[model samples]
Target: MKLKRDFYLQDCVKVARDLLGKVFVHETKEGIAKGIIVETEAYNGAIDKASHSYKYKRTKRTEIQFGLGGYAYVYFIYGMHFNINIVTGIEGEPQGVLIRGIQPTYGIDLMKERRKTDNLINLTNGPAKLCQAMGITKEQYGMDLCNSNLYIEEGISIEDKDVDITKRINIDYAAEDKDRLWRFSIKDNPFVSIKVKS
Candidate 1:
């Protein structure tokens, strides 16, 4: 079943951690592609230095974050890749969870075609990679997650013992907030992005 908006209205950290093992589905004109969420990172707006809306800053790129929870915050990065994030928290609060990794569960052939590879690790191992493999683009920005073509759904239940927590990746620029343990992954999940440093 599709997750309700209330599921994303809670704390960003909670939603990020709980998102592991859920199914992320994206339906496009080409076909339906789905994957089990294996990794995520939480960004608490205003207070989170790593967030685009940090200090409550609102720009055209971040305006959607301040809207109601359960929306897609798709954005282009590095001038080439697109990353998909789920907006969370109440309207104007601007918290979001980055979907870092997913384990392909449906439309594997379609994902491989889009990614141009059959290697499981290369399928949807990172946020940008998953967006590409799942045919998600910046056009999906602001799409409501609660009831939209792209949404998360119930999948296998992940146990606490099967989870691993670590600092987020590629955001050392956040300074002191860089070390915060906001990244969560399913323990031993090969599809998870990268191994957390010890």
Candidate 2:
């Protein structure tokens, strides 16, 4: 079953952790690809220094986050890679959950071809890489995940013992927020972007 809007209308930190073990599906014109979410990072809006919408800054790229939850916040980074985040919280709250990694379960050939790699471990090990392999891009920005082609589905039930909480990656500039331990990933999941202790 597809996750509902209410499923995303909660605290970002909770949503990020809950998203693990769920299925992330992106049905594109090329084909449909599915994967099990294994990693995620949460950014608390308005107050979080790591968030683009910190202080309620509403630029073109960040305005989507200020809307109701259950939307896809796709953004371009490094002028090359596209990263996807799930908008969370109520209107104007602007919280987000970044899907950092997934293990491909369907359309493996399409994912491998998109990534130009035959190594299964390298297919969707990172945020941008998973986006590429799944054919997700800026075009998917602000998509309503509750009803759109891009959405998460109910899959495996994740237990507390199977998850590891850690600090986000490469956001040391967020001051104390860098150590907030907002990142969540399945323990021992080889598809995770980074390995860190809880």
Candidate 3:
């Protein structure tokens, strides 16, 4: 079933922790693509130096980040890739969590069509790649995951023992914040770009 608004209304930390076992699904005109959410990174709003919306600074690009919870906050990075994040926390709060990886559960052919390659291992292994496979883009920004075309769903249950936590990768710039250990993922999930010890 599609996850509800309340599912994402909680704080980023709780949302990040609970997201490990959920399934993220994208239904497109081409086909249906799905993945069990195997990894995620949280960015606390304002107070967090790691958050782009830190200090609640609103830009044309970040306006949606300040909207009600359950909205998508997709943005382009490196002038080439799109990173998908779900806006979390209460209204006016800009916290979000990046969905870093997923284990593909459907539409392999469709993923291949979009990616134009045959290497299944390379298909949805990272954030940008997964967004491409699922047809997510800036047009999808601010979409309500609870009722939009793109939404998260309940999937295979994972035991608490099977989930792991660690500091998020690629943000050593956050210094002491780098050690917050806010990243969460399923242990040994094949789609995860990084391996984690449980």
Candidate 1 residue-wise lDDT at 38? 98
lDDT of 1 by residue, 54-163 (tens): 99999999999998889999999999999989998898898999999999999999999999998988899999999999999988999998878999999999999999
How many steric overlaps are in each model, in order?
Answer: 0, 0, 1
Model 3: how far residue 158 lies from native, Å = 1.6
lDDT against the true structure, per candidate, is 0.93, 0.94, 0.86
Q: Who is ahead in lDDT, 2 or 3?
A: 2
Q: Candidate 3 — which residues are off by over 4 angstroms?
A: 196-198
Candidate 1 ranges beyond 4 A from true positions: none
Which portions of model 2 miss their true places by more than 4 Å?
Answer: none
lDDT tens digits, residues 1-198, model 2? 999989999999999999999999999888999999999999987789999998888999998999999999999999999999999999999899999999999999999999999999999999999999999988999999998999999999889999999989989799988889899999999999888765
**TM-score for each prediction?**
0.98, 0.98, 0.95
**In model 3, what lDDT does residue 189 have?**
71
